[model samples]
Target: MIKVDNLSFSFPQKELFNNISFTLEEAQHCAFIGTSGSGKSTLIDILMDPERYLFDGKLEMDPDCTIGYVSQFSELDNTKETTVFEYIGEPFIKLQNEIQSICTEMETSTDIEPLLEKYQFALDALDAIGGDDFESNIHKQLNVANLMKRRDSKVADLSGGEFKLIQVMKEMLNRPDILIMDEPDVFLDFENLNALKKLIHSYKGILLVVTHNRYLLNHCFNKIIHLENREIQEFDGRYIEYNFSLLQTKMELQELAVAEQEEMERNDTIINNLRVIATYNSDASRGRALKARVRFQERLEARRIKAPFVEIKQPNISFGVDNEMEDAIVVSVHHYSVGFDELLLDNVNFEIKSTDKVAIIGANGTGKTTLLRDIFKNNHASIEINADVKVAYLSQLQGEMLKDANTILEEFIDAGFKTYDEIGLYLFNYGFEGETLSQKIESLSGGEKNLLQLAKVSASKANVLLLDEPTSHLDTYTQLALEKAIEKFKGAILMVSHDFYSVVNGMDYVLIIDDKTIRKMTLPKFRQMIYDSHFDKDYLETEQKKKSVEMKIELALKNTDFELAKGLVEELEELIKWL
Candidate 1:
């Protein structure tokens, strides 16, 4: 258990939090929710005692408590030659040494022998924690993060998502009483996300998580703590309740602000009238009038006016001519196979017709993006295609494309767009206006760059669009706006995405790729396939029984029945083995 009392923090140019207070009891799970740049990460950093930050508060914890933190970014030594088993087992190695020391210091007895048995017991525990299958777990994490298959590969060969998952798995293996994870679900696929949820549910500790994923937050968080306007506020219940409560609070604040402004205006008018009359009256009357005016000013200053909340505006994309083409195949992949060593995609054949919206779906690392790139390359290679079939490609991190540019307008001009007015209009539609449009591209954030890229694509006269993970960095509202835009587009679209909600809502056709093959299906059929594949009768029954047993054991342990708890633990172990 831990408590933070009257905590305040600020950076050089901005105040992050002021007089924030919160508590995390034993086994409690809390989530920090806020918009981007609201200082969630800074608060976490202060709690974790990271250098280069200042803290002005009291953080009280149980003297024996141990903390384990998983950062958003992972730092792995590329040259260490450490296998996954050794990597996760490193934490237990220290425990094993301590156990050995205790055994050596104690006299020989039955108790000593039982206690000494813990060294070997710890080894078995490590294996049961998946140490023996550590390599497999690492592969699973990497694959779920969409990294290529490279079991013996160095960490340097991994992408940002891959490294982040590896760091998370490492922290989980430590089994600390206080776990702080920052955005664990950011790069994971559905399968791995479920695995992480199961693991967190099974954990017996205090969990403080920071994430933007609504699904994970809704499922795992028991309470939400929001940081806004240099203050912290707590909301009870799941994400849905918290969101609703937040909206209600914002509306109330806005109403109060309107009332305060009206009062201030009324006071200003009275003060003005008093001043006008006092000028023609005696000195005593003038002095009283000036005093009244000062009091009114003080009252106005005392009124707590909430700062206006700025909402990011959605883009208005107008699709040009809806000239449906019967023979226009925007993209075609014929007998295509791609891999680093082994085949990831094989004999993949697909064709995109004009006005068709196709969603490429697969388990992570199944070469969805590779397939898109192949299609783009093939389209570029074709010489017989018409000149009017203009294509625009949006990569996963499209912002990186503008790193060298001085300004967004300059980048747009360099990208061969004609007019600044047209570019400004497009930027405004994507939530960038006036000063933002003139901002240097090198100084823009990831989300800002993403908006700029979308604006550029919308301004282009391209009829065929290729988007890879377009919605990954976007918020829920922006994603919905993009879905609407895609629906309005008259051109063909080839997109690869893992966001299930967007896939279900926006995609017209689904292409499932696996083991170097592609299978085409309608959206309805794809949903059914995924559901039926994951929730077969046998698996459902097993999962139900597993949950029942876990609940029973938890209830028994709550009553301080040690013998029953020990027995239940053993039974649970056996059940896990069976599973």
Candidate 2:
């Protein structure tokens, strides 16, 4: 259990949290969420090591609690040459190795009693970590993550997403009392994402996960801790219920705001009348009345509603084309194959028309990003891009498009922005302010870096866009904005995405990469396949109905129809139970 009281933290440039307090108790799975650059990860850091920060807060942890953590930006060192099984079994392996060494010492030394005691201690340590069937347990965790095939593979050889799941497996198998994972779902393909959901659900200990994946958000957490507007809002319920509570608050706040506006307008009219009377007659009573009316208006203004969560800013992302391609195929890949040690994709072929928006989707390490990179490079013998097409590429690796050594302002200038003023104005739409422009790119949060990448891509003015996992680090609001922008892009788009909503809501069709070959699937078939593979058809159907009713309730609330809204809330409460 962890508890924080009256916490306030800030960087030199800005305040990140103000008077925020929340308690994470036993058996609670809390989703930590907020807008981009809102200090979710920073808070995690403070919790992990309170001494590293200088802040005003009371952070308490139970003395008996054991904690495990998985950071957002973690990587497997390729130079170490560790395999997946060995990595997950590290604790057990160390203990087992010590036990073997103690037994060997017993064979050579006259102090056999001490060596026997040491061997027993090592065996006890191994048992303490549930290492009785360590190898099989490792396999079980890998199977849970859908990475059983990679059990024998080198950890360095796995893709970024796969390695991330391995980290999760390692941490979860350690069986700490409390596990804190920061954005663990980032870069995960759909199946791996599902695997993460299962792992979180199956975890018995306390959990505090920072994630923006809606599927995980909807399915995994039992509690919600939202950090926004320099404050924390904690809810003791599921994410869906928390969201409904937010919507209800928004509805009531909107009504209060409207009434407040009307009252202010009427008070303004009264003040104007009193002013007129005071101006016409030099009566002391008239002047006093006008002063009273003005004071009333000021009080009303102070009481006006500015609801949180309802007014969160979303990045303004719009993709544009530099030149039209005259209705031709903008990109074409034929007989393409790419891999290092093996053929991940063999004789794959796909094409994107001048205005087509297609998604490239597959399991992790199945060559989705590789294929996109090949198309963008246009160097392979089988890859052909139209001569007239101008291409812009967004890499999943943010470093590919950004220089860590440069400031935000410098990066844009290097990217061809004319002046600081222009860059400032442009970056403002993407949520970077004038002061933040001077910060080094390396200092930004993962979501902030992704926003910078999107801002760069939008300004490229290319007829062909090759985006690899563009929504990986973005928050939900930013992700929705990007989806809208992708929907309206007037050019060829070959997007590699694992977001089901992004693909279903924006793309025209999907190019499936399976079994080392590429094929196209219509949107309808893709939707059905997703429902079949990841979710229950009945559950999704109920979810759809729930969404429809929620919208109706919003409409009712907007119209100030309390009776209708009340009825819909009852209906939704019943639906929530089923979900």
Best by TM-score: 2
- State each model's CA lDDT, in order: 0.66, 0.88
Q: Which model scores highest in lDDT?
A: 2
Which lDDT tens digits does candidate 1 get at residues 1-579? 878899888755456788889888876778876554457777777767635566788878777676788865445576777654445446656556665666675655556676667657767666545555655665555454344254455655554445555566667656667889876665566665665665566566788887766557656777777766677777666765555444334445555666678888888888887788777876796778778777977977787765423233445654444244565776666667678856787777777777788888876667887767656655433212334577777777564456545688889888777898977876676666675567677655444566566766776657888788776545455666778888888888888876666677678988887556988989878766655754444543454465576666556645545456557655655544443
- State the lDDT of candidate 2 residue by residue for 453-472, as single tens digits: 98998888988889999888
Checking candidate 1 for backbone clashes, the offending pairs are: 346-516
- Each prediction's TM-score versus the true structure: 0.66, 0.94
> Residue 317's C-alpha lDDT in candidate 2?
95
After aligning candidate 1 to the native by TM-score, how far in Å is the CA of 220 from where it should be?
2.1
- Total clashing residue pairs per candidate? 1, 0
